[model samples]
Target: MSEATANDFASLDAGQLAALRRRAILSCAIGNFFELFDFTIYGYFAVAITRAFYPSGSMYGTYAAFGAAFLMRPVGAIVLGAYGDRMGRRAALVITIGLMAGATGAVGLIPTYRAIGYWAPILLVLCRLLQGFSTGGEWGGAAAFLVEYAPPGKRGLTGSWQQFSTQIGAVTGSVSAALLASSLSEAAFYAWGWRIPFLCGFLLGPIGYYLRNKVAETPAFERAVETRTVEHAPLRVAMREYGTRMIQAFGLSIIGCIANFIFVVYLVSYAINTMHLPSSAAFSCAVASGLVVVVLTPFVGALTDRVGRRPLILACALLNLVFDYPLFLLAIRGNTFKSLLIALICNAVFQALYTGTIPSILAEMFPTRVRYTALSVSYGFAVVLFGGFAPLISTWLVDVTGNPFAPAFYVMTGGALSAIAIISMKEYRDAPLE
Candidate 1:
């Protein structure tokens, strides 16, 4: 393949290239799907995990442990992101899936605090950190893979698959949690039932590794290597040369990441614990919102190719700023299953518009040589700073201010920041990748 050269890719007929793109998409999508599934199941099962790991039974300890994972993300972004830029995207993706899945499986097997004392929470936090580290690399690597493989006019559609897989993973995780929570007795669920999803996620790791290994290296990365343009030190180059671009990606990521965690991941918990809604109903509603993202994101992604990335993403950011507070009020005051579902779905629609285009935007911001490291670092820091601790911070906001609508303020802050980024960004929808 080293001798094959960029001309080899150029020589491929349309049918051959199309087939190759599909394989690339499937291979890249699988790892992200599994990664998100495993990560999300932990969030969905936080209540059970809190009961098992925290002796005091206060969710603060569990939330801290959850937030601890985010702290490792930027480190992973710098480390694994550089690895991907240097070694290869495929190599880094394979390693991330193994580490992520292995840690997830370990979480399933950990003994509760009653059985293991303080060691239980220690073990749980360790596993979460490992998951976070792997996830930091997985998303950027996968996005780079897909967008690099994408044909000129179809980058948005191809890149959307990254977020599409993510939504599917969340859907599956929500469904798994909903099923287990609904079917098991409360005592049983708190005991062994919650481990089932984690273990199942573990079982799929090897399969993802195998599929990724079978796929070819992306044409863009291969060309960079062939041209001797691959950066030996991508992280340094990115920091020195692309600081402004990195900031743009970071700012753009803020609202989407926060909204995803707050509305999609945390809302279930908020519904159950704060609003006192039924667990089954909350998870089911999450599934509905996730489905909306899964179904709508691709179409919205395709739309961006026609309408321009700036318009849709800017609209999403502005709308999120305008509507999140009222929606939170609707859910908080009404406090019904239907009301919560409606609010979540509305958030999901806005979320889809941004997420669908972000993969392409991030990928387009930098050249193939330093793309992985730069994109990963920017996105990872944004998530760690704004999104990763969303649940904990939102909880604290409510606790301190005595307002259940407090989380909306957090989401609105992201929207405002991201709107500035979107407004400042150059429209890259029709631009070629560097």
Candidate 2:
């Protein structure tokens, strides 16, 4: 009955709606890619970084330090998510990208432990925290921006591109790091070769900034502001009105966090440490899996649009539970390129189902005023619980069980938890965000 509601209803036509949705998807995806690239580059280059800064330390200690950086992510999410609700999604995104770029560029220039004593690790942790904070803010803003601009009938498809961008960034970071590492001598790679990917983030940052600036504010946000329909305190309102949805989001995110940390981070470590594969080979597998994820992400997104998010997410979770042991067994036992390929393929396919639909589903869970806050808080908390701890937990599990397949069981547990959570969520495809 309101003017904004009337406009939304009128804008649901097929032709012009398609064009706007495309623009939104492209803008959100490109901007998100840069943010994720900066975040993920650390994981891909963690070994080289550890050697440079913690040369005499145990591998577990080095990884523990790395996980410490992940702890800052939820704090960033709470701060920036609230800001996005109060200020604007575009402003939050712009700020986050700038922070990520600055932190990443500084990483390239950080002195080695030999040069700065304890100051080296201190600086590294500081920069990583800043990067975590920036990325924490980036996800919710980007998701809300894309989903709000999506066409009525195709919101899931358009929103999925935001997740797809993460794979694009991961692939880029892995390939670039592999190429740079390979091109340099071992001595050179340890000495100075590892900084290239971090430095590359400088170029990516500005490009993301430019692309994001071109995107208009989402119509949903604009309408809420124009009509003063926004909640007085979005965080409180979300807690009061949408607490159950927040819980659902956290559960739905478990499998994705598990898959990403295991396949992308833990697998890289496992290949290098356990299987004794060359770092190049390990990175190549990661790059290959990322490429597969990027390609399959959109298709999964489209599938969600047709069939709904609940079924797709549950199916992926169930398949992950079934394939968990076999996938890791293949990757570890054979330790061949072929084995890695099969494992990576299975992980990527299952991951795509959840990743592709999450943005739209989360955005649709709340009204425009609180969408960013709700999504960011729930998502960031899940990352802290599931993703932030996954690598460390997987390593600890393996050490305790002395079985290489321990990580597979850990991964399956997460999938089972997610399946239970997602299956209970209320369907909202036809529900309007008022």
Measured by lDDT, the strongest candidate is 1
Residue range 1-434, candidate 2, lDDT tens digits: 24564376356777766676677678778888888988888888878888888868446655665676568777787888888887778878888998999999999999999999889988988898898888888988888888888767788887888888877988899998788767888789878988988998976799888777776667777787777776667788899998998999889888888888888888887788778888888888888888888998888888888888788888888989999889998998888877987898889888888888888788888889899889898888888788877888888888898887898998899999999999899777667866
Q: Model 1 segments beyond 4 Å from truth?
A: none
Clashes of each: 0, 0
Q: Model 1, residue 52: displacement in angstroms? A: 0.7
Candidate 2, superposed: residue stretches over 4 Å from native: 1-21
**Model 2: number of backbone collisions:** 0
The global C-alpha lDDT for each of the candidates, from Candidate 1 onward, is 0.90, 0.83
Mind giving the per-residue lDDT tens digits that candidate 1 earns over 1-434?
37475667889999998898899899889878998898878888888898999978777887788788888888888999999998889999999999989999999999999998999999999999999999899889988999999988989989999999988998999999999999999899989999999999999988899999998888888888888888989999998999999999999889998988888767778888878998889999999999999999899889988988888888888888999999999988999999999999999999999889989989989999999999999999999998889988988898899988889989999999999998988988877776
- Taking all chains together, each candidate's TM-score versus the true structure is 0.98, 0.94
